[model samples]
Target: MVTVLTSGLASSLMDRLRRAAMKLALGEQPPEDLPMIAALALADGLESPALVELAGLSRRDPPADIRDLFTEALAELGLPMPRVEEAWIDRMLDAARAMLSGSLSPYEASDEIYWCLCHLDRTDRVTEPMLLFAGLWSNWEDWPDGRPTIEQNMREAAADLLRSHGEQVSEHE
Candidate 1:
């Protein structure tokens, strides 16, 4: 048996992924929802189906480690593995860590981060520091892309989250 070595971060991520797969399997959340469920597990309160779909679209050419883990999980669960690409999976995993750790700068924010933040905000999980960081990087100069600047969006998101949590944020404050 070849022992595959995973980095500390990878191991942590894999552990989370395994736990998520087990939970979804035990909870009867349907096998097809694995990618999204896994994404949610990897990033608390963050859900991006587009990212999951992108991973699926790239599954035909997956990395060895991803394939190994995916195959192992499916086999253990007696479920047929679905087409999920490693590249997208890795991207989603990395994004999950970045967002959760508040390491993503506004300049580095992509549609994925925006959507994830929106989801977190809706779920009342948005934090003050996260909002400040997002706002700091969110500038109108980056506008014209149709979507509002990250700062504006983050500020609004922060307000919404605060409001949902019963906090009254004054306009001046």
Candidate 2:
């Protein structure tokens, strides 16, 4: 009997994912509605780039179709978009000053002040970019509870989420 190694199992799974993605690409049916579908994929822990590519392959545009819904999603979670300019510096500086005087430490204040900048860095003004950006880079020291190498961790999280929802992540190319 031929013993299938772990790599063999992974290879088999990847092949299945490829087949599924190809099927979607060919069928042109796509997943369900846009935001929910994208949200579902996000919940499944799919990275932003993967999600974007998958969406492109599946031909879905949840965010574009429902800007209100996307905005609602972000607002519901109290996530603010970053708007940077010299005009805003005074306000930010004031907040920084207040934080400095208050119990918040410089490190904490700096983090809060740079939070939006970080968001800008992550998203490049794109909705899906932030998640993958954050998820991929979240394991760094600058990020909370970040480990040395957490790409696999992020992928596993995405996979587990998708699996729990009865969704499948196509073995990426």
**TM-scores, one per candidate:** 0.27, 0.19
Q: lDDT by residue for model 2 over 103-166, one digit each (tens)?
A: 5543443444444234333434323423443545444435655542453444443443334335
| Root-mean-square deviation (CA) per prediction | 13.3, 19.4
**Candidate 1 overall Cα lDDT vs. reference?**
0.42
Residue ranges of candidate 2 with Cα displaced over 4 Å: 1-137, 141-148, 170-173
Query: Residue 77 in candidate 2 has what lDDT?
Result: 28
| Candidate 1 segments whose C-alpha is farther than 4 A from its true place | 1-93, 96-105, 127-134, 140-173
TM-score for candidate 2: 0.19
Task: Give the 10-residue window scoring lowest on summed lDDT in candidate 2.
Answer: 78-87
